[model samples]
Target: MGTAQAAQAAQTTQTAQTAQAAQTTQSAQAPQTANAADPGMEQAPIAYVGGMPPVMDHMIYSHALLDEFEARADGHGGQFRYDGQAWFGTDYDKLWLKSEGTVGTDGRFGDGDHEALYDHAISRYFDVQSGVRVDLDNGPTRAWGAVGVEGLALYFFQLEATTYFSDRGAAARLQGSYDLLLTNRLILQPQVEMNVYSTNDRARGNGRGLSDIDTGLRLRYEWHRKIAPYLGVTYTSSFDQAASMARTRGRQVHALTVTAGLRLWF
Candidate 1:
């Protein structure tokens, strides 16, 4: 009976040892089993990512207009007008549209001009742009190819220079403006625009040389960045044959007037 009891105890010990060895082997092989089951587990740290979004695309569809509304002198009579440009897109590329015209008291939209442009940033402060321009009234419905540059100069001044070309001829326009901040919300802006031509278009009453110039000084108080009311003084003058054409139409070649209007953006 003593021998039989010793043999039974040894058998129990061997069975326990076998169970412990099986558990040890499973622990060592568990990670290898998982890696074989999922091939991605081995390559998870080095998987490639492709086709990312454009670096500049995160800022989309921001738009603004620096000058949008006004009333000005045309002759002994006068006209209300809105001249504005708006742009939208990412910082690197954008679409631009500009429109201006007189709203006649006689219920006509006269002297209308419109342009559509694509703007590409070439430097930190400037863009190169190209587009089409259409003169809607006062001239034949003429379309021209336009190329231009618009930018900040000397940090505080805004400037634009553009040339237009069509079968009739080529013309150029230059514009500049500076803002004087009287306070956080009060601003004084002095703006100037000049137009020149390469040939005469009698139907449109445009001259071949320096044709006309407009200069204005405006003071505005902005309740917000999106809106402002302004009062200003403006002077417009014609030169060379352009002046003669104005005289022939009995229109004032040079006029000074007061302008009161709003500047708005969204």
Candidate 2:
């Protein structure tokens, strides 16, 4: 009987050791299984370092209306001219600069209108801008307050309209343009612009109401997206008192010009 009891106790001790070994192995694997099931180990979105936005969030663009390179008999005998605009910032906010005019053969630039403005987007496709305008020509060098809206219309048309108030008088301007693709690299563009005044500035040969209209059609082959050479025709006409005023100054009320120019951006 004594031998049998000793044998039974030995058997019980071996079974308990086996059970402990199994428990120990399971405990060793517990952390690894928990990590495999953890939600924190899943894929995550990219995190911006140093709490800063991406670099490509801002943009800059510019273009020039290199008009009048080849012009017909206009007001002043022979002149070189350029009209350009550039802006910098995000799509919703920007600083804008625009200038257009002519420099005579005598190496002087007098006929021009320029502005510097702050642009604020009021909608996805529209911005309201306010700034100052400076006019130079046969008239006095005048400075004016400018307010305007510029944006896209009808999904593609680019449009801008501005009103000006100055010590001399009030004025408004409208500019619009549309682009048509003739080929993958060839494009046709048409533009129209108008100027109106509340009062006539005889010194500047401007009418009290509708002063002038400028219309142009251009065809361009873009050698590259950043640069294009264009050839176009421009028609400028003066009306009412403005036309009579130009005649008095020995200038024609209408001028037709051929335009050749390069439009570039960086």
- Tens digits of lDDT, candidate 1, 69-151: 98775447777878888888888899999988878666677668899999999998999999999999755788899999999
Candidate 1 lDDT (Cα, whole model)?
Answer: 0.87
TM-score of each: 0.77, 0.74
Tens-digit lDDT string for candidate 2 (1-266): 69999999999999999999999999999998999899898788778987776776356644344332333334456556677777776776788888888776667765689899999999988999999999976557889999999999995899999999987889999999988999988999899999999998887777989999989898988889877888888888899999998888877688787777776665
Question: What is the TM-score (0 to 1) of candidate 1?
Answer: 0.77
Q: List the residue pairs that clash in candidate 2.
A: 70-258, 71-258
Off by over 4 Å in 2: 1-45, 48-77, 137-139
